[model samples]
Target chain A: MYVAVKGGERAIENAHRLLAHARRGDQSVPEVTLDQISEQLGLAVDRVMSEGSLYDRELAALAIKQARGDLIEAIFLVRAFRATLPRFGASEPVDTGAMRVQRRVSSTFKDIPGGQILGPTFDYTHRLLDPTLAEGFVPEAPATAEASTAATPRVTDILGRDGLIEPSPQAEAGASVGDLTREPLNFPADRDLRLQNLARGDEGFLLAMGYSTQRGYGRNHPFAGEIRFGEVEVEFAAEDVGFAVPLGAIELTECQMVNQFKGSATEAPSFTRGYGLAFGQSERKTMSMALVDRALRARELGEEALAPAQDEEFVMSHSDNVQATGFVEHLKLPHYVDFQSELGLLRKLRQEFAEANEAEPMKEAAE
Target chain B: MAVLAHAEAGEIAARLRSLALPDHQDLREPENGLVMLRGRIGGDGAPFNLGEATVSRAAVRLASGEVGFGYTLGRGREKARLIALCDALVQSRDFGAAVERDVIAPLREQLLARRRKVAAETAATKVDFYTMVRGEG
Candidate 1:
């Protein structure tokens, strides 16, 4: 039970004004434009776009500027803005197999097809803080190679061809796909819903959970099957258009994990796979998602659900940072009436205890 | 269609204006919206809803009774309208060739050029490794 006490109208108004003022600190310096944020602080925008589940780079940049670089707040802003728009329809599932792959690497095999292109990675860089970067420097142009016209088949596909890996579960024909945004998540959710939940789950939370899996908590002997960052065409089958048209291309990072699978009675002795896909060049997030995804598959694989990462209900419920922040941040709201009731109860209990202690002293004297 | 979705709004507007196209009415007003993107589970597996992307679409009708629809992947209101206008023109007998030559061909070139530049840059980063084996060295 609760009562509403409202009297912060002016204070709330003034606080907003103060926030606006603070956002535009040192007005003498040229204000940062959305283009600058979009181009320069691009990774921040990507993170917000991924977590917000909205793929508008410009809007994400605007949110970042409004939130003053607070990414979670920026994600919240993007989510709020996205709700105002009507949905057109779901796109044709993007064909990553035909992606114009920019960066592709396979840890499982050194000599895989398309020969391991290390496109614009920080993996080889020494962790040195360079002062020259602050001053701005342009590195020399890189030497060129002809991009292989040969299609880069997925590492998983190669393994699948030889029956070395468990086959991907076939999708049911004529079954409607699940959309969490349109419906509340019911427990024992199917893989489709689970994948969707994990797709938008917080990077940090998933990262920790993923790391836990590798540290022997629900370990699956994971290997990076392949990580690819590239542009893939988005096809939309608009009814009015009368055919599927090329909507546009969007950058996506895909991670496939090959995990060791011991054969169950009904299953074959073959390697298993976990998958992750994200909106932009977000390899780190995708990798983390893949690890947690495998961990969450413990039940289906007949593995013991002994770790936090393996607990699907616990993991999925707490995965959303937006929901977590809202419930946690609501503590700052006025709870004076509730607190007063608790305070009154505590005082009464103390009084009763003191009276009981007094009676105990008298009883001891009588004894 | 790909060029229309991928081209710059400013370029699309400039191209459309140069043609002195016939007046058009909006069948559907240019409106921004969302499209939920999807992905297959293993790139060859079950479909799952990935995320929503910002989109703007418009429908236009020409005087010649041909209806045109335009859908672009981002929030470009004017771009969607211009694309709609072009779509309608392309369907009409009189203006189809003229609109293609004046508007779409150039825009397609622009899209191709943009893609090529990025492709070249990305291709330059592709690596080639040579192994050194030590056998009783």
Candidate 2:
């Protein structure tokens, strides 16, 4: 008794029109501008930029508007737009040591060099909504202090100096880094590729995986050695110029997690490093990224890869929201023809079953 | 020769754009687009996408058959085309000196002045920390 619905094209056209109206929402009311989203909903834009793998604040804001504030949808839009752009050249790696840090903190030490600057964080804020903000009342600004220009060294370096942490291996100069977008991810991905994937991976997925690690699935005892947010200058080499030239700066959030590693037969026990860096003030994402990154390094550290978080293939393949959403949402497309065939087979089997049951009773009576 | 910084090149291009450039054939018309910015941890470790930035680029061939290219951040199509023209003109022995004197020098001065102003502003925010030894075990 299934009736195939028609007018799909007409319905879709009308749906889009309705969506446009919904996006505007109450024509009498003032519309939200791109600047409003970019300035006020900045964290949302940051997350979209971080996960979307795009950085234009204007584009991120527009995408947010177009997606009706569905962050994942905005991220999908950015990712799709990113596919059309041409690649120039990769910039030289940014110098985090020389970063003009706006915020720098460490959980490992009581007081570290450059001191703990808790710049513009919601860490201590109570979960209370202020009604005055809705009434458009601006609050008094916090007291400003003279900015310190001291070099904020990495907290891991302090542990490294004492031979307490496992020495990090250095990448060779002029070594080519892999681009996950351009190439398919292969098994046993190196640290570079793993980090690249995690940087643009879905924040929620990474957060859950990171939570699993902390909840004793992967069980890497980690200390937030350093979480720093700031701007760093981008430099690229021009062909005519034999040396690197500085481009304008971009904002960044970097996290270095120091995790405990027990002694193996060949080496002594020491702390290991798990690093994460993203486009903006993505504090939660950076922290989660650090944890998940550490969990993924279980195999590299010669530890047992027993948990789902430790399984590189599983985590990497399913972490991209764009791919996940597309495949999952594809089910909503027309399945009428395929399902109808299945319905016909089901009916035939049922009729045959009824006929066989009827014949069995007769045969029994006859016997 | 000291290589010009990206900002410096950008500034020169901007100045050149305001003044306009000699007539040239559009080898590649100015197109505004986006480019993904990538970064790394600790300057040498794992790589990550920093963000996307707006960029415009164009190419031109001068009447003298010298080809030039220009690129700049943000949607400045005329700026990009002007830069391409300047680049081509710089390649010409006849026009290189005049372009450098008229365009590049003024931009460099402006850029340097801006840098000095920024440094002064930063200096105003400097803080000096003082420490004293306390009795300890």
In lDDT terms, which candidate is top?
Answer: 1
Over B69-119, each residue of candidate 1 has an lDDT whose tens digit, in order, gives 888899998888878888899999989998889888988888888777767
Candidate 1: residue A30 Cα off by (Å): 1.9
Model 1: CAPRI class: medium
Report fnat for all candidates as fractions from 0 to 1: 0.78, 0.26
State the DockQ, from 0 to 1, for candidate 2. Answer: 0.24
Q: Residue A251 in candidate 1 has what lDDT? A: 87
Clashes of each: 0, 2
Residue A43 CA displacement from its true place in model 1, Å = 1.0
The Cα error of candidate 1 at residue B112, in Å, is 2.1
Task: Please write out the lDDT profile of model 2 over residues B1-137, one tens digit for every residue.
Answer: 11122344456655556544566798988886765566665334555545566666677898879987766555567666666777788898878887788776766676567545543444343234356668743
Please give, for residues A230-319, the per-residue lDDT of candidate 1 as tens digits: 999998888778888677889899999999966877767899888999988888889989998888889988888999999989889999
Score every model by TM-score: 0.97, 0.81
Regions of candidate 1 where Cα sits further than 4 Å from its true position? A264-267, B135-137
Top DockQ model: 1
